[model samples]
Target: MPTITGFDYRRVPVAEDVSLNVAVGGSGSPIVLLHGFPQTHLMWRHVAADLTADHTVIVPDLRGYGDSDKPSGGYAKRVMAADTVALARALGHERFALAGHDRGALVAFRAGLDHPAAITHLACLDVLPTLDMWDVMRGTTAAVGFHLYLMAQPPGLPERLIAGAPDAFFGHFLDLWANDPSAIPPDVRVAYLDACRNAIPSIVADYRASAGIDADHDQADRDAGNRLRMPVTVLQQDWGAALGYDAVALWRAWASDLKHETVTCGHFMAEEAPADIVKSLRALLSR
Candidate 1:
């Protein structure tokens, strides 16, 4: 996509083999924003620009996505969380507000749990916790999550299948998950498709790790009675109630200071309902 007009783009090294493609802008308390699948830090373009008036917005394409290096492994959320924390530290922010959408929300959750002191506030958009996600995704409701199962399968098949029709596969979500098709401009849609097409294997590997290592990390946290101590805000699309579970109650178990609310929009809330997202994030940051 076009360059982020007011931002400085850089690749921040987080590990020996991994560096994150990040765009930094704004001023005041930092807010590290992580993008989800089939997209990049470009997904935060509108939101980041709006928040720049009062917050330093750091948007990064999490490892294995966008322009970031796609290592063979290390897609687990915990590892990704470490990348986020290190990215913030690399930028000279010791503690900051954090918000993530979709897969990035998983990383933010892990970051808050694993490095509570580093994240002053947390916001998760449009996802339940990994374990709770699997719990609610059963019977007919699981149908919507077919891609999750497909990507979670053994490596070879997923990589091959996605590579075969990368645009169709990735574009499907961009189409189906948006309440307003116009929200994703034609150029932005093309950018997302191109990025996903080029990063097919690494993208699938990232999802595959979730079924294995990421689940293990979530379960371990539950078993150890770990919870996010920082102020937390969750904005979702009411998937939990529709799927016969209480989303707020599920998130309550994980966050000590929690705010849960449903907003009207498709999965791409950052683009479809950016004003609402910005308002909620500002509230979270203030807390």
Candidate 2:
């Protein structure tokens, strides 16, 4: 009930004592789907169902969220990306197509950059890479990302502040970031809120890594001239003009063969536009 229908769920150990809560279904080529912030693998329920008809769909709650293991640290996108590659390998796939939303997209971006041989194709939804994300947010426009700064702090306060009102703190994003709130059903909304309630410290650790380690890793990769060698497709909202930056051009620097499209939906594009997500994933897999 906490997962996609017709899928089998299991805990796959990707690291020493770190197991990911994964939902897998379908057949043919494998494609691992990673979920975003304050949500679980259930975000891919609708898209997974569709992809299952043609793919071996694997959806996992990244180590810190949902029913997955939550350790004190190791939340950097680099570590999470390695976890994902390990998860896919554990699931009997040496290489596969990959897609992710929000926080997961950052992980996916790292995966594609860090594990070029393991990821055949990559798709990122509604997120900019770590360096570009910080670069674009300037002045009052940065207010939209206040949570990033909050959780990016030294840790104690952010976790405590969020834990103080878990529902309100987490629900703020579920409500504010969605163009169509109904895209996330009432039951699913409760599930997301509950997951965030239990993962305050780990979630903050994930964001905190972005502020430090993740950004440093990204900067290093940029400096090294390393790029994603696989075909990549990016789906996002119109964050360019509003944020005062060029989204596609920014992504182009990271990916060589890139297809970037702007979606007029909410931040939760997988739930809000499942068919489009499925179509995009299908195309990426084909490429």
Candidate 3:
């Protein structure tokens, strides 16, 4: 896949055995953007480009995605959050704004809660907190998260099934979740599919970690009465109404200075609604 224009890409070591594929660009206050599952840092192309005029935009593929080295383990959000923070620090940023979509949002959530001093502002797109997410998955509603269940199973099965037809499995979400598929260009879609196909096992392991270790970490945080101290913004679909609960209320429990709003777009809001997402990030950064 080709690099984003005006951005320089590199592999930065964030741990003893892990290196992150990061793309850095722009100037001014630093802001690191993290991509979700089934996609790479490319998902942030539009938003990163827009923010580059006023902010130093750092885009990195989460540990198990994109060109990043995919180790078989350490997929927990806490570990992933450490990678993100370390990436920022490696780039000479002691504190920076952070934003993530889907799986990346989960990592950003952990980052904000665990490293409050390092993350000045946090934006999570289209995902509830890990613990709250599992709460909402019930009966028929859980059908929306079939992939999660499939991945959470003991490793071999999910890895085998996904690897059997990686592109079809990964591309299914790209087609189904986007409000307008065209928002993701043809080349971009191909790149995502290609990357996912090559990294099926690590990808499955990443999701698997979420169901097990990530949940444990989230529960521990909740038990400790921990909440995000940074300015928090959650842009999501109205899952609370769909699941018969209060959406904003659930977020309020975790964030003190929170701007929660429902957005009408596909799951890939950063690509589908770049302008709105950019505006939202700017507002969060300003806070």
Candidate 4:
């Protein structure tokens, strides 16, 4: 099993009753990396290890995911983004680079909009903003994101249904969403599965927020003239071609300075293509 070596781990409180499981390493300008769905901070093992050579790497399992506190509420991306800012500040960084994959990417997008002054640079992998995502996911094409609809339903059923056979349900994505499943070695895959299994309700709550409050919050931002002020990079699989929309154009509405690339790999780009992701982050940092 490849762990994030040389990084010290700690439980840092970002709220009254919520503390995040954080892993910090290296020393330089800071960059906080947030993990996506069905995985924990361990998803950044490859990218974090490489960046630790010159940058302060802050990796944390979002409050509901990994080893972090899983409260009944506060799963909204706005709140989650606030949790991230507090986590960074609690660790002595007032402003830093921010990057996220999947759900984390949504949170990062919110953070960029909500705390523009606090995020010097931003990167989002494999997600559209909450509003854009709901807008574009229409008709039969939306069937590909069945899980999104499943979790978005009013609580009880989604939680009980997923909890029934967590592995089979979560494993379905782990199996299908990757272009290179081998990239996730056996232990890492097991780690992801274990984490997802234990966090079903909170995970569902996280997704549920995306359907409700997260989307409403995004719509509010869109109603205003708010947009990301910092340099931004978005890397995603060519979903537009399949889903019927321009990915770059969609992102352009949200970011003033944007670099959107259509990656060839699957949705789990950070783990599936870390070298390409690292290069993009370094390039974004340079700008």
Best by lDDT: 4
Q: How many backbone clashes are present in model 1?
A: 0
Per residue, candidate 2 scores C-alpha lDDT tens digits across 1-287 of 36688999999999997999999999989999999997999999999999888799999999899999999989999999999999999989999999999999999999998899999999999999999999998899999999999999996899889889999999999999999999999999999998989999999999999999999999999999999999999999999989888899999999889999999889999999999988888887888
In angstroms, give how far residue 269 of model 1 lies from its true place: 0.6
State the lDDT of candidate 4 residue by residue for 1-287, as single tens digits.
Answer: 33578899999999999999999999899999999999899999889989998999999999999999999999999999999999999999999999999999999999999999999999999999989999999999999999999999997999999999999999999999999999888999999999899999999999999999999998898899789999999999888999999999999999879999989999888888999999999999999
Error of 4 at 226 (Å): 0.7
Return whichever of 1 and 3 wins on lDDT.
Answer: 3
Model 3 lDDT tens row, 1-287: 85778999999999998999999999999999999978999999999999999999999998978999898888999999999999999999999999999999999999999999999999999998888988888999899899999999996889888888888899999988988999988899999999999888888888888888889998998999999999999999877888788889889999989999899998999989999999999999888
lDDT of 1 by residue, 1-287 (tens): 66578999999999999998899999998999988877888888999999999999999888988889999888888899999999999999999989999989999999999999999999999998898888788898799999999999886898888888888999999989899999989988988898888888888887887788888999999999999999999999988768999999999999979999998898999989899999999888878
User: How much RMSD separates candidate 2 from the native structure?
Assistant: 0.7
> TM-scores of the models, in the given order?
0.98, 0.99, 0.98, 0.98
lDDT of each: 0.90, 0.93, 0.92, 0.94
Better of 2 and 3 by lDDT: 2
Q: Candidate 1: lDDT over CA atoms?
A: 0.90
